[model samples]
Target: MIICHCQSISDQDIRAAVDWMRAADADTIITPGKVYHALGKRADCGGCMPLFLDTMRQCDSFGVATAAERPPILRPARLRLAQAR
Candidate 1:
């Protein structure tokens, strides 16, 4: 399915870009702009954003990871043992 008509980006393209990005850098954040760049395209009209985002969300790699879900808290285990502090 075409997600961004202006860029001719499809759902597979988006997923491929996302997976490529994730593979390139696990800690990197994925965005539509990056996907466009990866596919060597750009956004024209802003109209496709809604469907674009919907398609993006369908990817398995499209959500916040557990570590990024919330800020860490100061604790004895983290500060003394794990040193995550």
Candidate 2:
């Protein structure tokens, strides 16, 4: 299940990278570039992006939690007033 032919990356490699990244930093956003970096490889042709993204999406720890799962950001009252003005 080679996902990126240019980088010789397989589905397993992608999954393993994703898992490792999630374990290392639970809040870090996992992207294709990060996956490539984690695997010590880089994208060459850009043709595998579709399949690469698909494989990444299939991983259990591939995505970050929705806004609901995290605390809402708080802006200063002065900033809010400035924006309103």
Q: Which candidate is the best by TM-score?
A: 2
| Cα lDDT listed for each candidate | 0.77, 0.82
Candidate 1 per-residue lDDT over residues 6-29, each given as its tens digit = 778889999998888988887776
Top candidate, metric lDDT: 2
TM-score of each model, in listed order: 0.73, 0.74
Candidate 1, position 19, lDDT? 84
Error of 2 at 13 (Å): 0.3
Clashing residue pairs, candidate 1? none
Task: List the candidate 2 regions with Cα displacement exceeding 4 Å.
Answer: 64-85
Q: Which ten residues in a row have the lowest lDDT in candidate 1?
A: 70-79
Regions of model 1 farther than 4 Å from truth: 65-85
